[model samples]
Target: MALTVDKLMNDERFSGDNVLQFLLYLPFGILLLVVRLLLALVLWVASIILPNKSGVRQMLSTLACWTFGVYVKLKGTRDPRCSVMVANYVSCLDSLAASHVLGTISLRKWKVPPFFASTLGIRNAAQFVRKQHFAECPSKPVLLQPEGGPTNGKGLLKFTDWPCPLGNRVQPVAISVERMFTNVTVHGGDSRSSFPWADALWFLCTPVTVYSLRLLPPVERHDDDDAAMANNLSAAIAEALQIERTEFKWEELRPRGRAPPSRRAGGAGDVTTLARQVKEVLPAVPIHDILRDLAKTRSVDVTITNFLEGVTPYTPEDTTEPRPSTSKPRYVTPAPTGVFPKSAKERQLSFQERKAQMIAEAKKRYIEKNGLNLALNNC
Candidate 1:
């Protein structure tokens, strides 16, 4: 396990394709996108005369896999026959992965012009509401990331206030993503957090991504209480990813123990010796495969088990296999707006609370504007 996670992430070689992987698959991704567009147009025109439905959706699903050259393996039991699909969020690519097996993605909440919405099937595929409420199983199977945004794939974040709002009985789907050899996984905790395209680029540019689609046994309203069922489903996903469990919110899980600063201040350090020591404990599997499972599900509880405080310093030792990295775009993901969040409890705000927060922000802006106006008048 000399292959520390940080090294693979920073080495710059494993950033998806070498000259070959990109030249080979980037064209495919682009070509398939063109094909997808052309086919969608043809299907739209044909829908006018054709009595049967156009198969554009099925085509989109298939093209997603071909475009990336990255393989997808969807396992476990699933029957959209049950209605709604609840999934664990990892990357935005989860939708593409689902499209391979399911139909058109839920257009989400994008407000497209009427012309585009009709042609692209956005009108029929989208869903928007103040709150997700109880409903019958959707006939066409609606996919929802109840967690709202993506996570590191190590543990489950706090679920939005479902409380059985969107039907008490639901099928939980775990969409686990493995980003070959990188430590960072796809995530979108909030708008200020990370963008989907940026994460997708990092994933696509990486060597390969293994997606595990685990469809859990359906949890019915009558079978268990809402909280219990959610816990069970979350635990099932955690077991699949081989990570620990956490029911707490994102910011609540940082501290280790009630120890002095001298005792715990060294968490962030250049612990090469510690890296070597902890490397010994990593599972005796290929780092690539280990990363796949880790991306699928590595719990936050164990996120600190190996490294001290800061990331373990990494340096590559020459290997037998020839390297495959040169002139790739140096991926630069920006930091969040502020170095730290304004509040610990605000990360998981509810719909109403979020609206209130937005209103307060607007009022603050107006007050500042008026204050500046009065100051100018006085001057």
Candidate 2:
């Protein structure tokens, strides 16, 4: 079976890529098993000696340096060591790719297979945390996949009811998955799988699985402000990954009985959530450009100083007395003496020129989008 657009679009598990993967991996399964054992043994020993997250993280990061022919491109400053990495859940390969850049400690679900149990699992490097006690303390940097589970890596899931359990000093990370051999980007699909074991094997066996980690600036919390921190981090993550923020909770969006209170309150909560989530995450900070666009749309100069603080720096001018009719709302005639187009042919030329310019601008924008997607896919 040859890899085709039909298969990729449909995302069948037994696509040509998977067949190639099977052939590539089956021959080296034993070698991979041995390597996994060695890595697990080393990690197990390190974990037994180092009871804290920092020590484990240090060991894992060190190990990542020696293994895998993978491409790990990390972008951003490393700071606030005690910060939870709120990253997008792509595939099982996330930890290994992430481990290459920094030491990560996860307080996720405690389900590690028996073979690598010592190095992984609740009792190992990643502490086991139940839902009730997810983030009871801020003692260490907890690796959190706020999406609850994996997605297609192209979309984002809604942040759970409680996104920030570790309380601020939040570092938002987005890990984009791209397989070099086949252009099949892994995530949640039938032709592919999101299981950690499968992803790990792919990483180890494949020549180069590109993992682009974009670490946005950390959000510092002065007090117990979890909601603000979660919103800010999630919105930043969404924007960084080029995905939409799922603001409405699932139940709230479902068609049901009388709906919720906030729905009845004219979605005030949703407005507040979006406003609080808005803080510049774009490269070079295009807040000025955004404000300019907004001003043009509203026909009013925008003065939004602090987006995160939900502060509207400019208010619309009051029209309390209705402004006494202004200038009678009449169109003035075109200046006949100026260098304006006089003939129909000249006017047609001007219109065509403007039309061409508009088409050129549209093409430029479309090209930019395609380029970004290519970059995201690590092409």
Candidate 3:
């Protein structure tokens, strides 16, 4: 269906008596514009009187989310060390969702300079701009939609050439719309039918909507060079946004293909090895003891045998046939007993490796089971 703006400007839907309808809408349009402006003024006053930090912004965002009937679901932990968040541009709802759930700062690229300048929410949003860093102001996590505008639920060209500094590690987020609509006069307007205004209202008035924040693991900042950091940050954001890394197709918006293997090959492998080594080192721990410890302080159910089975060195040829039974009577080995890993780094490294390996294996299985035929046919 054509949008209201398009119907008014291009299609002659607004011709004849429609002109009268347009005239009727003029007053409501003016009223909305005024209310928006007042709200913006209030936000400006609040920013001046209250703290100019993420907490205030988040509280305001939560209120806005409630006002719009939006609920935010945060999946993973936000890296406490990092101060930046990057996400896919789905709708204007992303701003409210991100602010409320992540408690991080958000930013948007507007077609017009004064787009939301009159709304208190927008006024508060302006504080996240990258240029306002000199006022002893902490830079809020900026949310960019790169797409710049909405499309027909189709993700389009949204990334730009502007260099984003890596002064803060960025947490990539994905925003998905559970339900949405456009141009049915939930409120009234003739020219207010474009995506910008229509979407803003949908985000403002919807009764119930859900937003999910899938936080990818954070990347370390290794360099001080802005250019290099920006490039790295862009790459990280692209990965977080699930942009196709191998092919440069902007039209295909859905995440396609498996994540490329890490450039630091031995690094990820080291994690797997460490996990296996820890299991081997503590082989004397009884399965019950290990399981009890995991149940109390962790969620892992993996036993020493299972852990060893996963990371034990094996060759492709080893999978050619099953092992032959020995002549001796079969015997079940007793569980090992030993002290657990003590170093925090060692424990963390082992856990991360196991998680990464599981993710990789899952992806591999999915690709193998589905294959290229399914992807092309489904698409």
Highest lDDT against the true fold, candidate? 2
Give lDDT tens digits, candidate 3, residues 181-248.
22212212211113356556544433356766778776555755544543454465455554432212
What lDDT does each candidate get? 0.47, 0.50, 0.45
Q: List the candidates' TM-scores in order.
A: 0.46, 0.46, 0.40
- The TM-score measured for candidate 2 stands at 0.46
Q: Which of 2 and 3 is the better model by lDDT? A: 2
Q: What's the CA error at residue 23 for candidate 3, in Å?
A: 26
RMSD of each: 23.3, 26.6, 26.5
Q: Write the per-residue lDDT of candidate 1 for residues 222-257, one digit (tens) a residue.
A: 666556666766666666666655554433322233
Q: Summing lDDT over every window of 10 consecutive residues in candidate 2, give the lowest-scoring window.
A: 296-305
State which candidate, 1 or 3, has the greater TM-score. 1
Write down the RMSD of candidate 2 (Cα, Å).
26.6
Model 2 accuracy (lDDT, Cα): 0.50
